[model samples]
Target: MDHLQCKVFFGLVICLWTAKISQAYQTVENDLTDENSLASSYFFYQRPEYPRDCQEVQDHCSYTNTSGLYLIKPDGYPEPFEVYCENRQDSAGWTVIQRREEGIVYFDRNWTEYKLGFGFLATEFWLGNDKISCLTNQKKYELRIDITNSYGMSFYAIYNMFRISDEVSKYNLASLGEYSGNADTHITWCKINTGYENCTCQKSCENPHECLDTCDDEDICICPEDYYLMERLCVPRKQCGCHMFEGILIPEGGVHADSDCSRLAICRNGQLRWDETYECGNNEVCEIRNNIRQCYCKPGSIGDGADCITATDCSDLYDAGFTESGVYNIKPTSWLEEAFEVYCNMSDGGGWTVFQRRIDGSVDFYQNWTTYEIGFGSADHEMWLGNKKLYHLTKQKRYTLRVDLVNREGSPYYAKFNHFRIGNKDSKYQLLQLGDYSGTADTQSTPNGYALTYHLNQAFSLWDEDNDAGSSNCAEGNHSAWWYKNCDNSDLNSDYHAAWGSDASIEWYYLPGSNYNILYTEMSLRPF
Candidate 1:
């Protein structure tokens, strides 16, 4: 005991036997973080003689910190067991041990092992036991633990075991101790902070759209009706004007009235002004009627009080009267007077004819014939009054040629009687080319007379009376009546003499005035 005090007395008895084995492993890890003998062995192994019946709870008990464990018990109440810890660096750790009769157990840290047995360990058991054999049958048991440390620092745990009733009510070896880096076995009941994860403590939100949920205890940010908090984001409430127009919104200082109130527009901030004292009067023309903003008149004009005048007149045919029966009602004052003058006091003799038209589709008949010579030049041939040769148009009789055209010149050439002939006065005959009158109202009065041998010799060869028998070549022959004007009366060989074909030459002092001529026309010949 004297060699340096015998090596300092065995190094103080090996440092007091290593401090009494580190105070007996810190008093058995502080009795597994004491909870009063694990809550009285979990209510003494789940009282009611527990054979797993919490009414057999099921509904796949919920848990999800990223899908880890679930052990249903919906209404019988077990649903609160979820523990996940993944702070990051390749974090890996998990453990779950359910066990009603005896089913579920999984452990991992890559030491992977899983089991789920029931009623007699349903085919598998030992999940690397930390303390297995618990529920001898008085059911109820649950344990979920997840610890992540490979520098990913994390931890979580949950344990409940309200039943097990058998083998000495197992599982209290200080509740199967294992967590080491103790800050008193640190648990702090989970807390993550930012988007929450078991956070029973730290929470804060500045303006994730004006508080989308996190900061409470009055840290404020509850904005939902028409929103409003700017910097912290909840926005949505600045209307001021709204102005749309075609899709019609127009709101702000709103005015819009106009269907006679002339037009008063408004809509300020979104811009759409128009009231200059309710406009539209210098001949008026704004438009857009029923849905507002209107003025009126501007279509050939005519509205007077608020201004608009120009509609000149021209629209009277007495509503188009003479409805059928050789239809005749002629009136030509002046929508430019196309051709006039017709006095056919004829039972067979009272003439005076003028009727003209020519913009190329020729039509004329200046036949004074007996009222003393006014027929010498532009009447190439359409004249067949009646009684002259005793109603002489016969391919076996059927005639009703009524012409009551008024004021129609060249706008599609009018005034009928295009070509006519009836033999026996001339002989070779054959020049029946009939009328193809022009538009703006015409009535051939066809009760049945338009069928003269199906239009004899099919119209338009005018006069081939045996090739002009006594030839004045009838004005350049080959069937030429010189396009009417002074009457090229085709002599059907000797005595029929009917004429038509005049596009110009009726100058007995050029009898008509109006610019394009042909103002009124009326010719009638009947023979049914």
Candidate 2:
């Protein structure tokens, strides 16, 4: 051959070789059974052309026993359908096959390709039309054959070949009758027990309980050893406690404490029990320190290891001289300047004493505001002398309060010294100044007309004056005075007084270079 002819011939040979390899690779094995040699022969045979005389099967085509294959349902009931194939005489040996289910022929196909040899048969078919062609719609369709040793068995085993087109793979829809003589048995506890004579099945439980094998009856579920049942739940023996203490389970009447030995925790009736006896001494109080309970003295009291005493016990020091010399400074500039200093010479009775003397050129007031209640003096101490204490000021009690005033820098307006026993330590205290003494006064009488007692029994109610500026006296430059009978006494034997600085009066305001000072003050209680 010439060079051009050789090249053309070689090209043709390459094309044919590629086509054969492609066909072999495109062939899929019949995975439904291992007893068949049908897959190998199916791809080796040449496919036939479309049948010209092929006709579409009608919607209602009667089926006859042809291929004679049947399947058993999953429920062990025999399926009523059988496989059938009808030969089309005009279609040149082509045939149409279908399977009937429930008296209905649901699957039908016409084969244009086949391989019949090696005691097996494999056919490629389509569900579309009688004219056999390559699958164009990609719908699931299958047709294959298997020859097995069960040749002498039932008809289902003899010609166990079948196919389902339309997205159903043969392996997925194949029945047990096609592959085996006996039906498939589902393995369950009851079935296993029934199959074996000596098999004893125990009850199954979801909870953590022991399963009991009841040989004579249904199995029973019971708690394990040392476990108790509560509401059908098994609880361990160690958890049978009333409550937990510090994350350690504690039984009823159990006592536990931390390693530091501060508080003793007790559990009772599934709860932590609290006892006042576990607290501090009678005069002392309990307090939390570093998350542990400890005993400490209450406010205004000092405590030793055993007992508590009033902080103001001045029995050791001699009596300090009393002073009525007090000067009211123009409403104190700040809380720090709102106080006066007094000196008690150790001649008077001890008790609470006050002294303000110049030490190192600076005034030492002998008072510590931080030690009092809310930065105010308590009954047990000498600090916060100006703080209001209505609880200590009772009805029918005679009280003598000393006062002194000095205006270091003279003022254009007159200022007064206002004393009050207010309901609370709030803005109401400033608006409810009870007694006002101006000019150079050293002593002021208690139960004055401006005291709270004065308003208790008045014909007009004090609450009605809530909106009255002069009565409420809450606004600046609108201060006034009021009086009422003592509410504590039904006989109205005593009266109380209240007063505030009026317009243009600098009662509580203090200005620099203008010293409105309270030089001294002394308060004493006496029996009525």
Candidate 3:
């Protein structure tokens, strides 16, 4: 090769080698914001097999091109595991640690139950002391999660229960108390649904070429996770019960009494008999309910009244501000009214105001007045409302509120009735809006910043909704977050919360922050 040619060839080779290595070593990580995005692997708890604690917990593991912190709940060891400092996605076998982001990625074992506190969704099926049981598609089964502390390790375990529309559908499910001895004795015991222990270390190989005669993984071949395997061969797993499983199988026809079949046994013609255990249908929690053994039931349908609703209901709850979309409305109660004696004073310069029972957050609008009264004063006598005292205005009531003033000479603020908190007593919160019969409420306007409308840039790319983007828009730093399309969903977690961008149509009014100790009557414009 010529000298010039040699140099070009060498450069090309180096570039190809670098690219190949990058491809082999990179992994993608993102914050787990959407509950739907979590994997089944995350919820699996084959106690007697895996401890059920978070594994990507050391730091946020990257998947689908985002980075986030993860944590387990319910006071197991490592109470608040500060998972990843910064989340990054680098290739597998690659050393890309320095790219970690500076935020938290969390694992929410508690999310399942957190959705239930409202008492509107499924009730009474949750395992452990907590109650937010998710019903899987299987016919006679229910699934719940329990987070427990074991020797300082956080164990997130799932409880599988049985259900029955017919008296026959119910089963008295039981599990072997996880074997407590060393791997040698192979001892075990029975208990209800709880506590997972590693069954034993299996040497089954992932690569067939590497198998030493066993040609399989040592895992107990649990359902769902093991659905890919049939007779130990990989296949698809979905929702339901089929072939058969061990237990006193429900007879082919309708009958109350148990036959000869035992859990781990099967049913052939019309009888409960023994056969190698097969995968139970979807939704089955692998328990011995009633006098039955190894039977299954759909999740959330313990009895006649407890059945889970269809997928339609699930979507409704998912949309019900659970994602923290806009400014959530706060309701008003009697204690709040008693706490603040709202007054509009033209003589003492009190102006118009809505007082909260506690430290006022901010305000949006005040009814029963002119539009002129809600903005900043254009003149000295602009008779506009003021947010002078957040904590203490020396009033008869403790007013936690949002005060609005028109055309404020200073920075403008925007907030909804949902933003204020009221009452040291009752918590019947309500947003003081036009109350369904919409009416005009004076609005406060402010100077604009590109803060909400940044163009395509690196910052935009950083907030990619899909991993498909290689070249993209995204700006750097904290300011870059709001510019994206879904910042509301992305930033609503309590750990790293950011108020979503606002739409001017909402007409926000809320009290600004209080430093009453410094200046009692404070006013500021907030639009978020």
TM-score of each: 0.17, 0.21, 0.16
- For 358-458, candidate 2 gives per-residue lDDT tens digits of 11212222222222113233323333333333213312132222222222344332222334333333332232433443333211333332222234323
lDDT of candidate 2 at residue 63, scale 0 to 100: 31
lDDT of 3 by residue, 85-139 (tens): 1222432111111110111222133644433322211111112212111111112
Q: In model 2, which regions exceed 4 Å deviation?
A: 1-279, 282-296, 309-389, 392-398, 408-476, 479-502, 506-528
Best by lDDT: 1
- Compose the digit string of candidate 1's lDDT tens values, residues 112-133: 2322222112222232222233
The global Cα lDDT (0 to 1) of model 2 is 0.26
lDDT of each: 0.29, 0.26, 0.23
Minimum summed lDDT over a 10-residue window in model 3 is located at: 6-15
Worst 10 residues of 1 by lDDT: 6-15
The prediction achieving the highest TM-score against the true structure is 2
Candidate 1 has a TM-score of: 0.17
lDDT at residue 429 of model 1 (Cα atoms): 34
Q: Show where candidate 3 strays beyond 4 Å.
A: 1-281, 289-296, 300-475, 479-528
